[model samples]
Target chain A: MAVRADDIPVPRGRPRLAGRVREWLDQESILGPVFVTPALLLLVLLVAYPFLMALYFAMSNAFIGRPSEFIGIRNFVRLWDSDAFRQTFQNAFVFTGIAVAFKLVFGICLALLLNEQLWFKRFIRGAVLLPWVIPTALSTLGWWWMFNSLYSVVNWTGIAVGFMDPPGPNWLGQKYYAMTAVVTVNVWRGLPFFAITILAGLVAIPRELYEAAEADGAGPVARFWLITLPLLKPVLAIVVLFSTIFTFSDFNIVYVLTRGGPINSTHLFATLSRVVGIDTGRIGEGAAISLYLFPLLVFVVWAQLRFVRKQAY
Target chain B: MEPIRRRRFLTTAAGGLAGILATRVPPARGQQREVSYLCWNNFAPASDKKLAEIGQRFTRDTGIKLKIDHVSHMGPQQAKYASEVQTQAGHDLVEMRMHFPWLYEPQLVDVSDVVGELEKKYGKAISSAYEGAHVNGVWRAVPQYHGMFVATYREDLFKKASLKVPDTWEDLYTVGKELKKMGNPVGIPISQNYDSISTAGPVLWSFGGMEVDKDGKTVRINSPATAQTIEWYKKMFRDCMEPEVLSWSDASNNESIQQGKAGWIHNPVSAYIVAKQRKLVTADGINHHRSLGGPQGRHETDTPRHIGIWKFSKNVEPAKEWIRYLLGKREVYDEYIMSGDAFNLPVYDKLQDHPVLRTDPKYAALRGEGVQYHTYGWPAPPSDKVQLITNTYLLPNMLAKAVTGTSTKDAIAWAEIEMRKILAG
Candidate 1:
C-alpha cells in the first residue's frame, strides 16, 4: 500500500531533463513554483508587509491627514502611562483567558460525548454549529439588542422576577460586570468551532485501539485518558493556538458591545488601536497597541512547528 | 479526506461566486455636469422630496446633474470624507459642520459671498448657522439647518407629572429624580458620538460647568463647579436612565423616547422628524421650543447642520451651482423650512407663530430666546479634537463613573488629564 501510494508519483521532486539538458531540468522545477506563486505573493503582500508596516507605524508619531514625526518608543511609553490603555490590555487578557478556557474544556467534553452511536448524530453535530455559522457582526448586533435594559431579555427577566426591585444592576454600565457580559458573548460564539474541530479528531481515532484499551480492563475515562487524549494532542494544540491568536486580536465583539465605554471597562487591543489610530487620529499610538499581538503570534508559530513533529515521547 | 477537500473547495467557490453576482452594476456615464453630494440622511422623506425638486430645477437651468448619496449618520459621513479626501474620490458637494472644518484646515475653499447672500435673505438669525462653518475668517460651508443642543421630553408626561418643564439646574435634577421614581427612563443612550456629548454637556453647564469654554481654550472640568455638575449628572444616571441608555445610539435614544420607554432625552429637532417617521407620536406631540434655563440663565450653543462644496471636487463648478440652488433663493429657503422644518426657522418673521414653535404673536420672543450670548458664545472645537472630547471625555461616561461609585474627583481629574493631552497634541 505504501509503495503504491509512492508510485502514484511524487511529482514535486521529479527531474525533467537528461544529462545534456540539466539547466532545462532546473527550469522544469518552475512548474512547482508557478502553481503556488500567487498564494506566496498574496501571503507576503496581505499578511507579512502589513504586519511589518504596523510595527514601523508603532514607532512613529503618525496621524491621518497630518505630517508624521519619528517619535520612537514614545507611543509605547504613553500606552503604559494611560489608565485607559492599561484597563484595555487587562480586559483583553481576561476576555481571551476566560473565553478560551471555557471553549477548550467544554469543547473537548462535548466532542467526546457526541462521538457515540446516537440517533440524529449528523443533525445534532450540524445544529451545534449554528452560533458559529451566523455572521459575527450580525450575531453581535443581536447580542447588543438583547442586552438593552429597556427592552433587553436580560433586563426583562431580571426586573420582572424580582431579582432586585430597585435595580437588577446595569450589566453593561457597571464596570465590574461589563467585561463579563462581553466575555459571555465571545465564549458563546467561539464554543462551536472548538467542539467541531475536536470532534473531527475524535472520529478519526481508530476504534481498535480503544477496544484494545478496553480489553485491558480500562473504563471509558481511562481509555479516553490513555488513548483518545494522547492521539488528539496535536489537533488540540492547534485548536488552542488558533483560538488564542484570534481571540487576542478580537476587535468586533468589544467594539460593537461597548466601544470601550462605561469608563473604559471593555476596551481591547484591536478596538483601542482603531480608536487611537483612526478615530482619535493618533496613528502612532494605535500602531503601538496593535503590535502587542505579534509576540502572541510568535509563540503560536513556535508551538505549531513543534506540534507537527510526531514523536513517541 | 478527498470528499471533504472537494466540499471545502466547492463551498469557497460558491461563496465567492455569489458575492460577485450580488454587487450593483454602476450606470454608464453620460455627458453632463454631474455632481455628487455626500452627507447623512439629514433630509428624510420631507428633505428628500425638496431635494429632488431642487435637483431637477438645477438640471433644467444649468444643464448640470445632481447625484445624491446621503448616508444615515454623521460619524460614518465624516469617516467617508476623510477617505474621499485622502484618495481624492468623487464627491463634488459634501455637508460638514462644526469642528469638521478644522480637520481639513485649508483643504476646502471659502464661499463667504454666497453665504453672505443667504444670510441676508434668511435674516441675521441665519448668520448664526455659520458660527462653526468658517475657519480662521474663511467660510467653507453654508448652513442648511440648525440643530440646537436641547433636550426633548414627553410634553404630555411632563404635564401629567406636574413637571413645569424645569426652569433651573435644580429644577431639572429634582424633576428628573421625581420622574425616575415614577417609572420613566429620564434619558438613555445606547451608542456614543458627538451628538450625545454635545447635548449632555449643556446639562452640566446649567450648573455653571462648561467642559470647554466660549473661546475653546480652557478645560475647566476640574473646577468645584464642574465636579458638582458631574456628581449631579451621576445622580441623574443612577436615579433615572435605563442601563440600555449607555448602549444606545442617537437613533435608538429617539426610539426609546418614541416608544414611551424613556421620558426625556437631550437631542435635536431631528427627533421630531424621527418620531414622525416612526409614528411614535402623533402630530400633536411634535412640540418645538427652547431648552430649560440654566442656574445662571437660559442659554445653549448654536448647533447648525451645514453643507459644503468640496474644493477637491471632480466638478467644483457644478457643485457650487448646486449649493446655490439648495440655499440661494428665498423660495428655496422656504421649501427647506417646510421640509420637516429642516432649517429650524420660519420663512417670515411674522409667520414664526406656527403651532410648531411660538403661540400667539410671540414673533420677537424666538429671536430673544435664540440670540442669547451663551447660545452664540462658545467657539466650536476642531473636528479632530471634537471626536476625542466628545467620545472619550463625554458627559455620559462621566455620569456612568459617578453612578458606579468611581470617585467624582478621580473621574473629573482623569477626564481633565485626557482632554488637556488631546488639546495639547
Candidate 2:
C-alpha cells in the first residue's frame, strides 16, 4: 500500500525547516547537481572546450603557430580515408581492450595475494607499488634501457638461459613483439592501482559476513561468489572504470617503448596525434584523432557509472 | 701694477678655456669597439665552449665584456630560444639552428662587412669553415665548423666475415646481408632525428641526390637520384638493420654500435669520438675509420658548420673578435680540436689535407675516396618553411612507406604533396 502523506516517516532530529529544504533539494537534485557542478565545469573547460576546438580544427587544414584555412570537413575526410589514421583507430581499440582485460584479471589476482597475512606485510605492500609510485618518465626510461636491443638484461637473460636461439628477441623489435612489449609495459605500470583499490575493498568486507557464511556451511568459492563479490561489485566497477580511462590514454609507454613500431603496429591515438600534430604539423588531423577518442571513452564511463549505481548497497 | 694683474687674469681664463677644448676634442676621436656572434647550430656547437674560453682570454688581453647569446640547436632546445626571440627579446648571441635564419637574418646586425675587416686583422674566417657564406648578393653570415658523416664498420665482425670495406650502397647492402646471417646488425641510422642534416646529406649524396637548388625553386621529392638512393637505403634496412632501428629516432641506435651489438653504418665522422669515449678504440685497441665516399662512386660530406653574426647581436665588435680568436688563433683552435670533448674540424683546409687526414699512419685514412665531397648548411633552404625538408622524419617516412609496398609513383606523388605543403607553410 502506498504510504499516505500524513503517515510518511521523517528522519530523526529533522526540523520542519530542514525537512522542507531536504524535500525541495531532493526534488530538483539541487545540492546533488551543485556538488557535481565544479567537476562538470572543469571537464567542460579543460576536456570539452579543447576537444571541441580540436573537432573544429579537424574540419579544416591547420598548422602549428599559424592561422588555418577552413576546408569544411576535408581534414577529417582525408584523415579517415588515410591508412595511418585507420591504423591508429584499430590500434587504440586493440591496445585498450587487451590492456584493460589483462589489468582486470591480473589486478584481481594481485589483490587476492596481497589480502593474505604475511611477514613484512607493510614492506611487501609498499614494494608492490614501486612501479606505480615512480614517475612515469623515469620508469619508462628504465623500461627503455631494459628493452634496449644490445644492452638489455631481458634479452641477455633470454639468450643465456636457452630460452630462444642465438640472438634472442628484441622485445621491441618485430611488429607483433612491439605491441606485446608496449601492452606489457602498460599493464605492468597500471596493475598496481587497481590491485590496491580492490585490496582496500577486500579489507572493508565485514569479517562477520564471511563468518556467518562459513557457519552456514558455505564453501570457499560459494562464499566468495555470494558474499565477497556481491559486496565488492561497487568497488570493482569503479576500478574497471578508472583503469579503462588510464590505459586508453597513456601516451608515454607507447612513445618510449615502441613509438608505434617498425610497421605502425602499435600506433595509438596519443602518439599518432603527436606525430601528425607536432612532428608533421598537421594540427587538424591530429586534433581529429584525439577528438575521435571521446565518444568511445564516454561510452565506457557511462557503462561503469551504471554498473556502480546498480551495485550500491 | 693693477693693469698687469687684470691682463694676467684674462690670460689665465683664456688658457683654461683652451685646455678644456683640447681635452674634449682629443677624446672625441677615440673609438669604442664591439663584437657580435650568431647562434647558428651547425657552427656554434663548438663555438660556445671555444668562444667562452677565448672570451676569457680576450678579457685578459683587452678590457672588454663578452656577450654570448647566439642560438641553441634546433628541435626542442631552440623552441625555448624562439619564444624569447618572438616576444621582442634583446638576445646578445644565439646558437642558430639553420632555417631559423629567416627569423634571425633581418634582425641581426650585418656582420658580413665586419668579417672581412676582422679577417685582415686576423685571417680569413678559418679558410675551410668558409662554405661561400658571402656570395649571391647577400652578406649575412660568417664561416664556422664542419662535422661531416663517414662510413664505420665493426672490425671483429668484418674480419670474421672476410668482407672488404663497403665502397657504395651495394657493398653496404652485401655486407649487411652477410653480417645478418651471423645475427649481427648493420646499424645504419635509418631514422635520423639524431643528426638530420649530417646523416641524410651523406646518404643522399652517396647516391647523388640533390636537395634543393642552392637558389630556392621547387620541391625535388622524387629525383631519379633520390629515388635510387632511397631504394638502396630501404634494402639496407631490410637486409641489415634490426627491428630496434625502427623503434629508435635518436642516437640510442648509435649506442648499440658502441655496445658492440651491431656491424657497419654510414655515421657521423664524430663516431670516432664516441668509440674513443667508450674505450672501444685506443692506442692499444682496434676500431673502424670512416672516409668521405663509401663503396658508392660519387659522394657528399657535410659542410663544416658555419657561424654567422645574427642580425640580432648587440655586441658585434666583441662577437666578431671572439669569433676571429676562436677560429684563426692557432692555440685556441688546437686546444679545441685536441680536447676531443667535442667534434671540431681544423680551421685551415690544408691542416686537414696533411698526413693526419688521409695518410696519417695513426689517424685512419679519410681521403677523397669514400668521402662525399659536398658541404651543406653554410648555404641551405633560403626560408624557414623549406627548412622542414632538412628534418629527419619527412623523407624517411616517405622512403619507409615506399619500401613497405608503397608504390614509388604514388609514394613520390604523396611525398611531394606533403613536402610542398610543409615547405610552403
Candidate 3:
C-alpha cells in the first residue's frame, strides 16, 4: 500500500537531518543548553583553561623554556614569609577598599546630581564619562606626567594658586602620598562606572513609588533611605562586587604611575605577580601571588549574590 | 531523492573536512629567505630610520627579505622577550640588553662564528662586550654597543656654584649639596628605575661592594662595604636629592636636567643630545664628564646591547649575516653611530676612534668610556640569578629602602636574603 507524503518519516534525508536538529533544539530543555553552548565554550576556553593553568603553575616550580616539577605549597610558604608579599597584600586591600568606598559615595552623589534637572544634561553626562571611556594605560600615562617631581603640573598649579610652596607636595614621592595618588586615580577611573550603572538603576525605578512616598509626608532623605536605596540594593551590590574584584586585581594604574615604587607601597596583586612571574622568571611564585585574591573575591561575590537573593524575598 | 540528499550531505562534509585539513598544510617554498628582528626604539629616530635603510640594503645585496620590529625599551619589551623565549617562535634576531643574553642563553644560538669573523676584521671586542655576550665559553650573543652612565651636567651652574666638575663620589655629594642650596638640585634617581641601578652600580663598586663573587657561587651583598655605600647614598639623598627622587622613573633624571632643574645628572648622552636637538638647553650650557670615582676607583655601569639569534629561527644564517653586515664594516657602523648622534658606541676596540665620537666636543669625554664600564653583576658572571636580581631591581630597592629611612644594616640584610633566595633557586 502506498503512503501519502506526510505519512512517511520524511525519508531521513539531509533535509530531514536539519529538521530533526531544529526539532531537538526547539525543545525547552535542549534549547536552553544549545543557546548557552557558545558562551559556555568561551568561558571554558578563555577562563577555565587559564585558571587551571595558573593553578598548575602555582603548584610547580615553572619558568619559561624550562621544565617544571611539582613543588607543592613551597611558593605560597615562601611568599607568606616575604615582607614584600605581605606589603602587597596589605596594599591590595587598602587600595581596593579605599577606592571602592570613595567610588560608591561619589558615584551615588554624581548619579543623584545627574538625575536632577540641569542645563546641558546630555553634555555633562557624556563629559563625565570621558575618564572611564579613555584607555586606562593612556590616562595613567597622563597622570604620571602630571605627577612628575620636577615637571608636575599639579605642583605648578598649586604654586600658581599660592597654596603650595616652591616644591609642592611630592604626590608620589612618599609612601602615603603614593598610595593616596594611586587610590585617587583608581577612584577617578572607577567612579564613572559606578555612577553610570547606578544612574541606569535609578532610571529603572518606577515613578509611582516616589509619588506615593511624597504623599505619605516622607522627606527627600527618608524617601531615599526607605525607597530608593532598598530598590537600588541589587544594582549597587553587583556594581560594588565587580568593582571590588577589578580594583583588587588592578595593575595598570599602579604599574604605569608608580610601578609599585616608593618601596612597593602601591603594589597590587597583579603588579607584584608580574614582578615575580615575568620579571624575575619565578612563574610559580607569580602564579601563587595572583591567586591570593581569588578566594577572597569568590567569597565576596558569593555573599553579595546571596544577599541580593534574600533582599528579593 | 533520499539517496541524492544523502550523497550531497556526505560530499559536503567530506569537502569541508578536506578544506580544514588543507589549511593545516603549509605551502611549499623555494630558496627565498626572510628574517625578522625585534629591537628597542633607538635613542635617535634617525638611527632607527638608518637601520631600516640598512635592512633594505641587505635585501638588495642578497636576495633575502628583512623585517624589523621596534618596541619601547621598557617593561613591555621585556615581557615580549619572555613570551618569545617561552614560545620558541618569534623574530629571528632579538636585540638584548644588559642581562637578557644570560637570562635566555639556553634558547639563544651560538653566534661565535659571526663574532670570530668580526674579530678577525676588527680588533678584540671590548671587555663590556665579552662580559655581557660571552657566557660559559660560548658566544651566545653578538655585542653591538653599550650605553654608559656619564656625568651629564650644566656647566654654567657648576661654574656659578664654584664647584669643579665632580671627580669623586665625595665631590658629587659636596658639589650636589652646594648646588641644591643654590636651587639646582642634583637628580640621581633613587627609585626603582634603570638609572637608579646605573647610578648605584658605580657607588657600590667604588666602595668595593659586590653583589656576588666572581665565581657566581656566593652572595656577597651584605658587607661592611655595602653598608658604607648605603651610608653614602643616604647622605647624598638627604643633602642633594629632593624627596621626589624616591618616586622618579627612568626618564625623570633626563627631564630634570633638560628642564634646568638639575645641576648634575648621571645619565647617557641622550639627555644632552635631546637638549641640543630640541634647543631646550644650549650646547655651551651642557657638558659631559666621566662618572664620579668611588673610594676604590671610578667605575660606570654599562647597559650593553646584544644581538641574539633564536635557536628556533628558520633563517638563522640570514640573521647572522645581517648582524655581521651591520657591525663588521667600520663605515657602515660609523654611519649608524653618526645617525644616532654618537649615541651608539663601538664594541670593538678598532672602531673606538670613529669620527662620530670626536666630532662633537660634548661627547669627547664619552669616548672609550666603556673601559671603566661594568655590567650589573660586576665581579660575578651574569648568571640567571644575577639577571633575576637585576631585573627585579633588588639593588635599587635596597638602596631606596635605606635612603628612605630603613637602616643601612637592615637594607643590606634584606638584600642579602633576597639574593640568597634567587641564587638558591
Computed on C-alphas against the true complex, the DockQ of each candidate is: 0.29, 0.12, 0.53
TM-score of 1: 0.83
lDDT of 3 by residue, B284-369 (tens): 68898977787788788878898999898988889988897888877777777788887888778787777777778888878745
Candidate 2's TM-score reads 0.70
Runs in model 1 lying further than 4 Å from the true structure: A1-28, A158-167, A307-313, B1-31, B123-131, B188-196, B213-217, B238-248, B281-289, B341-380
Ranking by lDDT: 3, 1, 2
Winner by lDDT: 3
Error of 3 at A48 (Å): 1.5
User: Where does the lowest 10-residue lDDT sum fall in candidate 3 chain A?
Assistant: A7-16
Q: Summarize candidate 3's per-residue lDDT along A209-272 as a digit string, tens digits.
A: 9999999999999999999899999999999999999999899999999989887788888998
Question: TM for chain B in all models?
Answer: 0.80, 0.76, 0.91
TM-score winner, 1 or 3: 3
Question: Can you write out model 1's per-residue Cα lDDT over B130-241, one digit (the tens) per residue?
Answer: 4567667777776666545455667777777787676555666777877777777677452344545655556556556766665576777778777777666676667776
Give the per-residue lDDT digits (tens) of candidate 1, residues A115-231.
Answer: 877899989998889989998878988988777555578767777888866556566666666787788888889989999999999989999998888888999889988898889
What residue runs in model 3 are displaced by over 4 Å at the alpha carbon?
A1-14, B1-29, B368-371
